[model samples]
Target: MTELDPVIHTPARLRIMTALNEALEDGDEIAFPALQKLLDMTAGNLTSHLAKLEDAGYIVVAKTFAGRKPVTRVAMTPAGRGAFRAYRTALLDILGGSR
Candidate 1:
């Protein structure tokens, strides 16, 4: 017996992973506000989820200036991309390909 990697299976985390993975494949990064809108989550909720993903090395958050305003962007890490794929596959398996 070997211990398995900690699984991030929470619904919110799952949603975040899915969204980040989608954007990465499209060669685009999602803005914080857009993610919040898409997830229909509050600022606190989004921040908490983002922190969790960032701590787990699943995503990277970049803070930069967009002209005069500060902007935040989130992108999936390589490990995150792999894990998100596995997560989707696990989900599909559980639902038997119908959901």
Candidate 2:
């Protein structure tokens, strides 16, 4: 069995990563509030998960302002995409054993 990445194995984080991977083009980003809405997560909860991903160097978070309104965006790094693909392959292999 392939080793699993603990950083992205959590349920919420997995969902966040998967959503980001699927919904946006590589190197593109989603607004924090948009991600929260898409994932149906509360601000604090989403922030917590994002912080973990950022610490792992799996994702990038940018904070700025748009017309004086604060804006936060998140995007996956290339390393993150690679990790996610590996994770998915491992999961498939593990599950494949059941067939």
Candidate 3:
């Protein structure tokens, strides 16, 4: 059996990775507010999840000012993208072999 990535396995974390994956593919960054809206997560929830990913070196968090307002943007790192792809492959392998 292929081992799944524990970091990306949780439902909420999975959703987080998925959102970041899509944005990464589009060569775009997701703002904290935007990610919260996309995932239907609260600000605190989003912040915690993002912190986990950031700690794992899977994503980069940048805080800058948009005019006078602070803006937080998150982007998946190359390592994060690779990990996600590997996780997907593991899932597919399990499903395929199960059938």
Candidate 4:
């Protein structure tokens, strides 16, 4: 049996990673506000989970200015993509064994 990634196993974190994995498949970063709207998560809650994913080196958060307004963008790192793939494989393995 393969072990699931603890960092991404949490429901919120999983949702975050899943969203990033799908959204960023085009190789584009997602703005913080857009991500929040997509996930339907409050700012504080999203921030908390983002912190964990960032700490794990699974995502990169870039804060910059768009003209006069500050903008935050998030992207999944290469490591994050790999981790997410592994996590999915582990989940599939678990489910496959049940049948």
Q: Which candidate tops TM-score?
A: 2
Residue 80, model 4: Cα distance from true site in angstroms = 0.2
What TM-score does each of the candidates earn?
A: 0.79, 0.94, 0.90, 0.93
Ranking by TM-score: 2, 4, 3, 1
User: For residues 48-74, what per-residue lDDT tens digits would candidate 3 score against the true structure?
Assistant: 888888898988999999899999999
Please write out the lDDT profile of model 4 over residues 1-99, one tens digit for every residue: 779999999999999999999989735799999999999999999999999999999999999998999999999999999999889989989888541
**Runs with alpha carbons beyond 4 Å of true place in candidate 1:** 1-7, 94-99
- Judge candidate 3 at residue 10 and give its lDDT: 82
In model 1, state the lDDT of residue 30.
Answer: 85
Output the better candidate (1/2) by lDDT.
2
TM-score of 4: 0.93
Off by over 4 Å in 4: 97-99
lDDT top scorer: 4
The candidate with the higher TM-score, 2 or 3, is: 2
Tell how far residue 65 is off in model 2, in angstroms.
Answer: 0.8
Clashing pairs in 4: none
Candidate 2 wrong stretches, greater than 4 Å? 97-99
Superpose all Cα atoms of candidate 2 onto the true structure and report the RMSD in Å to 1 decimal.
2.0
Question: Model 2 over residues 1-80: C-alpha lDDT tens digits?
Answer: 57778999999999999999998888899999899999999999999999999999889999999999999999999999
Question: Ten residues in a row with the worst lDDT in model 3?
Answer: 22-31
Q: Give each model's whole-structure lDDT.
A: 0.78, 0.92, 0.87, 0.94
TM-score of candidate 1 against the unseen true structure: 0.79
